[model samples]
Target: MDPEGSRIQDDPYIQVMMAGSTLRKVKSRSWKKNRYFRLLEDGLTIWYKSRWAGRGHSTFSVTDLEAVREGHQSEVLLSIAEEFPAELCFTLVFHGRQGNLDLVAESPDEAQAWIQGVRKLIHKTQTMDEKERLDQWVLDWFHKADKNKDGKMNFKEVKKLLKMMNVEMNEDHALHLFTMADKSESGSLEIEQFVFFYKMLTQRDEVWKVFQDYSEDGEKLMLEELESFLSVEQHEGEQSTQHAQELIECYEPSETAKKQGAMSLDGFQMYLCSQEGSIFKPEHQDLYQDMSQPLSHYFISSSHNTYLLEDQLRGQSSLEAYIQALKRGCRCVEVDCWDGYDEDPVVYHGHTLTSKILFKDVISTLKEYAFRASEFPVILSIENHCSVEQQKVMAQYLRQILGDMLQTTLLDGQVPQQLPSPQELKGKILLKAKKIGGLEEYLDETCTDEVSDEEEMANCDAEMASTEDSPEKKSKAKSKMSRELSDLVVYCKSVHFGGFEHARSHAKCYEISSFSESKAKKLAKEAGTDFVQYNTRQLSRTYPSGLRTDSSNYNPQDMWSMGCQIVALNFQTAGLEMDLNDGLFRQNGCCGYVIKPDFMRDGNTQFSPDKPEEREGYKPLRLSIQVISGQQLPKVNQKEGSIVDPLVRVEIHGVPQDQAKDETSHINNNGFNPVWNETLDFTIHTPELALVRFVVEDYDKASRNDFIGQYTLPFTCIQPGYRHIHLLSKDGTAIPPSSLFVNISISELT
Candidate 1:
């Protein structure tokens, strides 16, 4: 049979077991009706088919000889010689009697041992329920010859179901088994692609033994390994969608402080009470009454109680003591005009005010306290102590009695007038203007006689030949003759005339107040006026003398460094007691206190308190004492002598003259270097003496003393150490005892 059809074309299970024995040898002569069968057990192989339509030929038909004698005959010939142990050849065929049978084998377990020797010759005459219905018709013919149903039977769907069991498929193998079980181009088969194409063709070698046991170690089956093979249904829905996007970006709240109620609570308690002492005690008074829920605005006066309610509304009137000190929270108030006759503006305070207080009874008590020109805005400093034409007729009757709420200036460019004329009203009503004698009378009336004396000696020989060929136009003609003598000495001291040719013909109007550089280099060398009007102690006595006590060219390491806005102080003499470590007063500049309020009381009290009060009652005395300036005093040294019983003895022979055993032997002396004098001496007792105490054992304990004021010591004293002495008194008594020896030398003074 052509060598058994070339051993069934070299084995696709021996070409499906010799094409099912050539369709059962042409099923009884040219296949009376197709019917083919092959089955093998153990080393598996199964094939079967049946069909009938025309052709007639019926011989061995006793149910086809009892299904070829008992279907899967003896379980496929006793497992085909124990599963085809190896060598086996093949050849077999049958036909004509309306039955078919064929067999051929070489390998494939000898074509499954010749289809298990023809199912052991049809199991010696079938039975066992007809061999379990022919083993489920050969396991549904190998599960319909699996296409891409990836279980195992691979050989291209067993050569397309053996050409549809010889029906011969065409249309390109039925479009390659309808797109090979449709691997997703969605044409069909998706029951997991028909159970992976029937387990890869009936478990092809158990589909490579479960893909080499889950791809052995070269790992890769992703989508998180098919989502851990669908473990716990996709990790709890990806952790509940990442915790709902972190609760929508944590706690919302920011749309511009929620539409400007600026997070309420009365605008955060007025921004925490504008900071300074931020009031809110009593254990945070329930967190300041829950952050002041409704209180809107109320700073209730500060800046030193608003300058003491503007100095008690300048000598009281119906400010009813400044509206009772602004209901106890006072804020600046002062006022005090004069010029009255009918020209109105009255108020009060010294300089012959025979009786005043009008300005319409202080604008009818600020219009009966409805006080709202934007909520109590009344800053009236005013003081015009009299004369510059009666203070411009009391600043035009206080601008016709507070018109435009009296912010001052009677005319000429209206308000903003700080003194060019309106005569010096000491109590300060702002009026500035006079800056340094109006450029020393505009360079003595513009170089007086307009440069005569031979054109000022030919313009000083053409400024010494243009200062070496125009040194910047000889410094712009000496800065235009020192800015025309510093603007004519600040326009003759702003109308208070006097110099600069008596304010260049009786000052009509002038103002300027600064510019000096030594009066502008002496008004560019005497070409004219040199108006002056100093003050910071006459500008520190016109500076230039080693720069007037050069405090190392004045820097002093920012002295005490804070916001130094002080502004005035000079108290050097005029009744000197002001103590606080007496440097008179200037550390960090501009401090005041020149006492003598009759030497500050207490010489047997009597109604004193000129301000500082409130002690144990409710805070407010604000006492910070310590002043010290008169150029930091200290410089005495010791001279005017004449010692008699003056005192300065120290001969302590192993001490012990009781002053508590010489102050406990000078506090348990050790290597005795209490600064100065040497070994020993004693004899200090001084009753109503006069001040002569000295003690120095280890004097070079590096120099100290720089003394300056505060002194006291005439009695009780003691101290003993190495020693020193030298007073003199036995009888001479010149003057060394009216308390003379005043050495005071404690260094550091700048």
Candidate 2:
């Protein structure tokens, strides 16, 4: 079961990849050069080099790759398809915001070999368990330290390895351990010996102490003793005996220990680091939330300016951005459509330097990937800046590309009293756009020519956004709308929001409103209860302010607190805001729709984000987290001889009253095995609405602290016990073996 063992011994594709091939790396139409690309011996990295850059090789791990798409799937690859055959080209799609690498092989066979080989490697990486990942991580470091390619290391190399792993060990102690590991009287230690030495050097004394507290003997724990540990430390309660038995049978490495109903230290550690031992509840990892509720009752995962890859201004607009957003479980994607060349429509940020993407191409991409991550309905939030003619073209593209997946008519052939549930609208694309009149009137008329003040204001505001004119002045301007495009609006009709009071009396359940971040925050603060009540009846979207030209995102939790169904954030931006959004939607199978808390969904219920104490059944929680230790943390600066002084911070984002953070003291000169053993506590007034974020940063006395890694999950998902918090990179990809060991306990505030 070794991660790097003889698993791929018979795989011909992998063998060919290891042999290497010269491929034409295509960056653009004209920039194509031959490069020698090969998979590293470890089978986890791809190394490539050009003759132009002598002795300078670059490598990327298989873990960094998101997918391997065959043929001309990328824009760069598509540009060169006229010269290169489809079978001879492939794309390496990297995770996060990394640009995709398009490559063309010498022959079709070489292309297929790389594609299949990379696919196999990706599958292996994805399917690896936590323990396997840890072993592979250790092996990777071993490969790095064995610089001479001898598969053996001497005391000198071992000492250097210690420093590389962020451990500044005493020379005497290091040599003593090295000698102890070299049992064969050999001057150099092999891989096995190196692993033994690593175990000795990085022993978890804290875990051993906890094991000693429960075990009658230092070596093993009997069934009853194991049950006691589960109940007392893990809070397993009545299920402790069963859970203990399961852990022993599953994680016990020794057959003798399993037969004797005894758990060894290895078994205990394995159980502690397994998925069952994770900080988040394993039961909540799937679609466990109620999805049958009306669409307005759920906080739908959404994206603002989905066409842009970077900042709104001067950012390249691409169809890949739409695909990425959809694949990340973003149900609602905003497309700012403007007039394009050749009587077609384009999507881009209006009045900015952002590049344009074909509206048809975006639709095709949406059709292909809309339900790939989540089967919930996708909302195409159209910010139309197109002329009436191009708008018609846009509508035609939507129908042609999306086909039956597009919901062009009302459900059950009638307008609903309330919006349909996500379950009912699954696998469908609903257009959120302006229409000529009400749903009934639009349904009856073939082409109604009307000048609606709401549609006029929306169109004018979008076109004249750069102007310093007020809302009143923006409303005075008018624009024409094509009936063909207007007919596509079914459930989600875009309308101008006049105030909470006006909405209470005039807004229909089928009608929706979009608010800028500033206005939404104002509404949430000035009239929280009304905002929540309004959302319970009608869908409301809160987007980033226009001033965020750099495509920064606002705190989505603030809008979410007021039960805004679509709190859109710039999906292209990566920060605390996107982290919070990902954390909230990470649960319920990441289906992009999370059911709002009970009070927030009930129109009659008077609940405000500012006054969680006044809500019915409000039970405050006392959360205690002991920041025990960190393991194999990444260096902030990946340079030789650099080490991080890491610190842990736990933040709770929710209602203003529940929002808080606490941090442990910094552990200097240690990124690996830095032990804090400090407890941080918080009182969450609204536990269901709260998100807990665990952040590791490199502490600095001078300047700002450098971010190491972070993990954020819903507060309700926090499991009470000794758990391992696996850290993720800023882009939300797993950084295996880099984790925090913590003890979490949550109880009702008495």
Encode model 1's per-residue lDDT on 1-750: one tens digit a residue: 123323434556434544444232221122223344444331233445544525533222112221222221221222243433223322232221111232223345544544554454344223323223333333444555655555445445545543433222345654565468666665555344544443333222321332233332322222232223223321224543333222112211333433321222222212212211111111221211111110011111211111111222232233333333333222224444545675555665333213345655554444333242123233232333333344445434444544454323233433212222211211212222122223324333433313333322222312122222325323322221122212212212222213345434443332211221243234323422122111100110011112222111121101101101111111111111111111212111111111111111112222111111211221211111111001101113322221111111221111012121111122111110111111222232211111222221211223642221222211112111101121111111111101111111111112
Candidate 1 local distance difference test against the native: 0.26
**What is the model-wide C-alpha lDDT for candidate 2?**
0.86
The whole-model lDDT of each prediction reads 0.26, 0.86
lDDT of 2 by residue, 593-690 (tens): 98988988898979988988998898888999999999989888878788899999999999999889999999878888999999999999999899
The TM-score, computed over Cα atoms with residue i paired to residue i, of candidate 2 is 0.97
- Candidate 2 lDDT score at position 673: 90
Off by over 4 Å in 2: 1-4, 446-477
Runs of candidate 1 exceeding 4 Å displacement: 1-477, 481-544, 547-550, 553-582, 586-750
Best by TM-score: 2
List all candidate RMSDs to the true structure.
Answer: 50.0, 2.1
